[model samples]
Target chain A: MKATREAYGETLVELGREHPEIVVLDADLSSSTMTSKFAKEFPERFFNFGIAEANMMGAAAGLARSGKVPFASTFAVFASGRAYDQVRQSIAYPGFNVKIAASHGGLTVGPDGASHQALEDVALMRVIPGMTVIVPADAEETRQVVRWAAAHDGPVYIRLGRSPVPDVFPQGAKIQPGKASVVKDAKGRGFGEMRPEGERDGLDADVAILANGIMVSKCLEAWEILTAEGIKSVVVDVAFVKPLDEKTLIELAERCGAFVTAEEHSVIGGLGGAVTEFLSENRPCPVVRVGVRDRFGQSGTPEELLVEYGLTPGHVAEAARKAVRLKWAV
Target chain B: MCREVRKNVLIMIGTAGSGHPGGSLSCVEIISTLYFGVMRVKPEDPNWPDRDRFVLSKGHAAPTLYAVLAEKGFFSKDLLPTLRKFGSPLQGHPDAKKTPGVEVSTGSLGQGLSMAVGMALAGKLDRKTYRVWALLGDGECQEGQVWEAAMAASHYKLDNLAAFIDFNGLQIDGRVEEIMNPSPLADKWRAFGWRVLEVDGHDVEALLEAASYASESLGAPTAIIARTVKGKGVSFMEGQREWHGKAPKGEELSRALQEVAKS
Candidate 1:
């Protein structure tokens, strides 16, 4: 198990080695955000902004404008909340090619509590014009997403968490921008054993357990729980929250007619909000959102915090069942 | 050229019917000195890789930038009347994407210096000789991000960067001193590790001299505390807080135009 932030740090060093135009900036949280790894490898290419997140963000925009791909890292709260104006004006407004790789997202940010946890980061980033928001589920996916962001020429906000998570995506798996990865099909076949596009189209599922970030693994557990109850489920990882995989979501809504969006973020405007917002306009389906219910985090272990926030696998399974019932009601 | 720029600025804001003419008039000389005498820029090639960059950090004074860019032939002077209009590239604030020759988008004060620092850092990284200049309002210094950017610039030892604080003592509400004083400006910048210089903001030759000295600095960024009156050229509007955001009317525009056009 490895944290997505760790993968981000490793990938930065790799990208820096390959692309001299790639520069990394951190606001005194380099060690915590894992950007210190890149700083160690390429000292000349790394800039430590020293607790000034806003300056770091604006500077990142400058670097991008000057034809460098700058990856600015800080805690998620500081990146999204503290430096929001800088992000909005300098980076997103100009559509600069800067990557905001924010770490310590959501309730699982451990004991730093509510002040540190960024529940509304995705919402803040997703609302901006031309900002690409991505929440990679695991290490491999994080690697793929980071590589993709480096090559892409626009503003991107990549939400990463503190705690280590189980690897869900297999090695050599590719990430297509604005596309969801179906981790499990209706027949209970996992990502490695999934049937091709045409064959999978005929299968119908009781619920589409759409998830992102660390919650993807919990949704897989929830899938197992639902399967034991004789319910067929399809688990999908919605990595890109901004340019949401509408094609996959439309297909999933048609196939299952029900969705339980799971994310280790706020239910207001994370994966759940994006999914519901999109579906209401396009495919209007019953979606039960399982996440932090408009509450602040507290000092606790990752496990205890997940339980306190009703983000466990049990909560996801229960939400899936409720979504199915709501679908029947409709 | 300065008179021409001042008259153009007056005409644009007067035509727009809504703009910060006071601040725009204040920074005319600073803008003129840099664009005309100091910075090495290619107006025909706005995106020239090696061209010097200028960021208008105090973006409310975009009339000054627009007039100068047009006078410098970055774009047609025909676009001047389109300021603050719908579907116009000249926006309420400086939008780098919309306007040609704008180095970066700015307006939400205090963020421009940070971006300028980023540009200077990038130039150092590429080993390019291009210098970066940013014009900020004295009122904009109250923002914490300005200091943050100042600290970062000095920390990075960006000798290729120079910032001018258009020290217009008025803001939208009242006198800047009465509102939120950012005084002792030169000392403040020095404390932040920048080499501070004081000059009469309206004197083109002095500004040119300061800009030349700034380019020669080796280890740290330079901050020119330009002492200026808010509405510099016009008689009734000069130093008037009410004119900070209000544009001149029909007769007012005529008088302001005559005042600006005079040598």
Candidate 2:
């Protein structure tokens, strides 16, 4: 197991070797955000903004305008909230080719507490008109997401975690922007092919557990629990939260009709909120969210915090059962 | 040329019914000097890679920028009356995407200098010779991000960057001295490691002299503190804080235009 941030740091070095125009900026969190790895290799291209996130964002916009692909890194809380106006005016408004790769997102940023955790970052970035938001699930996915962000032409916000997570996708797995990859399908009998239309006659899953970030592994464990109890379900890794894999979600909604959305973020506007907002309008199915319910985080270990916040496998399984029963009631 | 640009500013804001003319009048010479004398820019190719860049950090004074850009043939002068209109490309503040010749979109104060620093750093990175210029309001220095950018520019040794602060001494509330003073401007910039030059903002020759000095400066970025009057050139509007945001109306506009034309 490796932290997504570790993968982010390593991938940046690889990208620097490939793209000469790529520049890195950090607000005194290079060691934590892992831009330090890239900094070590490309000293001239790396800039430390010395704890000023707002100026860093503005500088990134300038660099982008001058034909440089700048990746500005900081904790998600500061990148999304502290420099929000800078991001809105300097980057998103003009549609600059700047990538905001913020690390240590959500409650997984353990001991730092609520002050550092970005519970509302997804919501803040999502509300911006043209901003693209992504929360990578694990190390392998982070590699693909970082490379994808480097090549993308507009403003992209990548949320990465501080805690180490088990590999969700294989080493060579490729991730598509605005697309969710199905890791496991119904009944331990994965569908070799998917029907784009709502052809539910041969559907086998009772519920779909959609998740991103560290919650993807927890949801996978929940899938195992549901399987042991004679319940069938599918687990989907939703990395891109903004342009949300609506096509895949619509197809999943057609078959299962019930879902449990999970993330290591607030229940308000993270993965769960994005799923419900889209599904309620497009498919209108039952979705039970498994996340921190509108409260501040406190200092603790990642394991202790997950259990305390009701974000473990047991909690996800319970939310899945609740969603299934709600579907039946409907 | 300065008088003509000032006339256009008065005409545009006067027609818009509600726009800033005080700060717009204050920096007329600073912007005109750069557009007409300094800065290597092509009006036909707005996005020419090697062209010098200009960012209006005090975006409320967009009327002045629009007037000067039009005067420089960036766009037609006929579109000046559409300021703050629903479907016009001329937004309340500067939008780089919609408007040609605008390098960065800025209205929220204290952010534009940071962007200029970035552009200067990029020029240094690529070993390009194009310079980046930014015009800021004295009142805009109250924002902490400006200082943050000041530190970055000096730390990066961005000699290709130069900024002009229109020190009109008046803001929306009242005199800048009363509204959280950001005075001792030259010393403040010098302390932040900039090559400081104080000049009379209205004198086109002095402004050009400072611009020339900025181009020759060696290591640090240059800060040209241009002392100016809030509402310059116009007889009735000079140094008046009331004209900071109020547009000239009816006879007031004609008197303002006649005074600018006379100047």
Give each prediction's DockQ, rounded to 2 decimals.
Answer: 0.94, 0.90
Model 2, residue B255: displacement in angstroms?
A: 1.6
Error of 2 at B136 (Å): 1.0
Tell me, by DockQ, which candidate is best.
1
Query: Can you tell me the CAPRI class of model 1?
Result: high
Q: Give the alpha carbon lDDT tens digit for every residue of B1-263 in model 2.
A: 88988998988888888889999999999999999999999999999999999989999999999999999999998888898888888888999999998888999888999899889999999999999999999999999999999999999999999999999999999999898988788999999999999999999999999999999859999999999998999977888999999999999999999888887
Compared with the true structure, what per-residue lDDT tens digits does model 1 show for residues A147-175? 99999989999999999999998887755
Where model 2 places Cα greater than 4 Å from the true spot, the runs are: A189-203
List candidate 1 stretches off by more than 4 Å.
Answer: A201-203
A39-73 in candidate 2: lDDT tens per residue?
Answer: 99999999999989999999999999999999999
Model 1, range B17-98, lDDT digits (tens) per residue?
Answer: 9999999989999998899998889998999999999999999999999999999999999999999999999998999999
* Candidates' chain A TM-scores: 0.98, 0.95
